[model samples]
Target chain A: MSITKRIIPCLDVDNGRVVKGVKFVDIKDAGDPVEVAKRYNDQGADEITFLDITASSSNRKTILNVVEDVASQVFIPLTVGGGISSVKDIRALLNSGADKITINTAAIKNPDLISEASNAVGNQCIVVAIDAKRKANSPNGISWEIYTHGGRNSTGIDALEWAQNMELRGAGELLVTSMDKDGTKQGFDLELMKAINDKVNIPTIASGGVGTLEDLYDGIEKGKADAVLAASIFHFGTYSIKEAKEYLSKKGINVRNTYD
Target chain B: MNIIAIIDYGMSNLSSVEKATKYVAPNDSVVVTSSPREIDNADKVIFPGQGAAKNCMESIYDKNLDKIIKKNSKEKPFLGICMGMQVLMSYSEENSGTNCLDIFEGKVKKFKTRKDTKIKIPHMGWNKVSKKNDHPIWYKIKDESYFYFVHSYFIDPIDKSTVIGETKYGDIFSSVIARDNIVAIQGHPEKSSDTGLQFLKNFIGI
Candidate 1:
């Protein structure tokens, strides 16, 4: 089978509305989650990932409604994440038409959650999200620490090792975000991605530091990631999904062309 | 109304293919159906696929689509994209347990590359396609136009005349094949840009 490169648009939802921040500060309300999702879908995004950045706190019910609204309108694959902790939350999201559920803080807090969710739903339905920051100490010495509460707290677990364990525990995919690179537009942390991907068998999506199409190419080509996920670049109209795919295609990177 | 029937066999990327088809063939009829009867009656047929070659062929057999495809290919325009195109070859080296559609006289072999190269196992990227035969599908696509490619195996046609386009990875490989009413592209037209869209339009016109 041909492995098609996926162009994923990530919607970070806060209080049921799409919001984006630079360096995770001064957050501005982007728009309604459902409306923004519809626009991405219409523009030919291969997949839509809705990250309920505030689901752990207030607006839990609102996230469900947002998922339902977007899921109903968008015909493409929808992956919901953020604040997805328990099996019941996964079941609810899946029942609401989410094709996959991504777990981060919950998985790190209780590693067994990966196996539990996989068993309840299915391995393919479970995506383990790893939010990491590069630390000065440690071998590869770039620490694979896990961040929680919308990337505010760091759990001192090695990110690469934890990713390997998650795959062993039955995560069908991994979403590795470089907290250091998030919203930076510098480019994806290729070294960090390669480290995690090298250890895990499941598909890994490299998040953060996606400034240009070259960054995406480097993420997949050099980092060996299965997919590249970005927010501000796509959200702020730095580049449309079509433009990104075309650039990737021209560079001889396998991407699903929107024009096709 | 140029109704295009996408042969659905429970594979990945079908939804994306359907959406792209709708974009290009807007105002025309487009639907995903597994029924042989519906496929036989459609104006045109698109076989979009992803997954193991064996499983895809098995799905076709389970649905009794082999005979339907044989009948339709001779009668109407049939386009196969990616793995859909690979299935058209005589056989595939991927998992020797299953037989392929064998529509084209070629064998699908795994790509062989030198260790010195940084290229990965699965040839994934937007590679240029060198057009050979001036088929209708090549319309508006300039010589050596790039199309998105993602596959580990490629078709080696015994009858070189059937090869319409070639792409290079470790070596030049058949990227597009055409024979009578059957046209298949290894790269995704749905994912390709204006050139890829134009190819779809030409195929629809055919």
Candidate 2:
């Protein structure tokens, strides 16, 4: 059967606390990771993602502890990312109760890490996160280029080409974040999403830029994303996951009936 | 006292299944154990698995769990999930072909997505499961209600009567199958939110 579109809340964690920022900088502390996760769980969030934005060696253990704490409380699927460079990191996070591990910077540096981790674990548990921004003028005329290190550096890798390579390398899912749309809250980069969604054979999660309920709708209906991942919208109390589901359901989007 | 033993063959992180079972039926003793005696003696057994079928079968065979599962499924209430459900079939095309538990007459085939088709493999996300028959497990979960699924292969049962629920991806496939004391689903009910908890509650109550 066809899958219903998902609405996920992405919590950027730094030093064991939930944080958010604009284009991966100017971070703002949101609240306790466990509390926010539990609330999202109660609100019927389709899934939750814990992104360790700190990307620091000292904060690595704290993030794992945070994952354990949140995993114990949340019943839905949990994905942990940030600073996951090797198969060992993937194993540690999965052991700590994360359902999936997202690899970003490490994957760009060493694309084979995607296949290595997927082979060690199942492809279903491996998520390759691609951060990109629209490139207007390029040698190859590619519309987007991959950005890494929290969107601070451009890798010059064609976004579409990288997405195809990740899928070929056995990535179960793709988390595509549009750096231009991050923290803007305007809407998702529909063009970028459509480009990757049309080519990739695995589910692609559209991240960044979700301001209104309609943006979430467009992410799936127009952008063709299997799941919509947002950060500030759900974290800052602008809207609830339940509200988003109700809104999507009203627009004829197949959403889980969370009627308690 | 209802003792629900979730057979742990080291194929899955049974913590979520145990936690959900406990949440649904607090009075019941939900144990995640590979002990054959515990599984055989329990009032009900929950068989949950994930990952590749080849690796899953290897672990099951290593622990000689297939025999225990087959023997217990006929006598007590049994629930299989994801890979746990697939292994109940006759065979799987995964891992260059692997023989399954042969409890059901069916074959597990991988999704064949054509180049022009937009259907994605691994079918990861939430989808509606249309109920075909009235069962205790369908208690609060409405017909065609959305449930989470993440799998590339699906079961094609020979006996259509055994299928209690069906879902549509590229083609319609059996998402939920039931016969006598056994109930199995392709979706992970533990990961499915509240409606899934209700499904577990129905199984526990039954």
TM-score of chain A of each: 0.91, 0.93
TM-scores of all candidate predictions against the true structure: 0.70, 0.92
lDDT of each residue in B1-206, candidate 1, tens digit only: 87799998765436546766777788889989998888987999999886668878888888888888878878899998988998888899987645688888879898765666434445644567889999988887888776766576888989999999988776788899999999999987765656677888898889
- Return the clash pairs for model 2, or none: A1-B167, A1-B168, A1-B169, A4-B126
lDDT, candidate 1, residue A158? Answer: 79
Q: Model 1's CAPRI class?
A: incorrect
DockQ of each: 0.06, 0.60
In model 2, the runs with Cα more than 4 Å from the true position are A20-30, B114-117
Worst-scoring 10-residue span by lDDT in model 1 chain B: B117-126
- B1-206 per-residue lDDT for model 2 (tens digits): 79999999988767678777888888889888999999998999999988899999999999988899999999999999999999999999999999999999999999988756557889888888999998888987788877788899999999999999999887788999999999999998887877677888889998
lDDT of 2 by residue, A129-208 (tens): 99999998877555899999868999989999999999999899999999999989899999999999988889999998
Once model 2 is optimally superposed onto the true structure by TM-score, how far is the C-alpha of residue A28 displaced, in angstroms? 19
CAPRI band for model 2: medium
Q: What is the lDDT of residue A174 in candidate 2?
A: 96
Summarize candidate 1's per-residue lDDT along A147-221 as a digit string, tens digits: 876579978787877888987887878888898888788898888999887776566788988999899999989
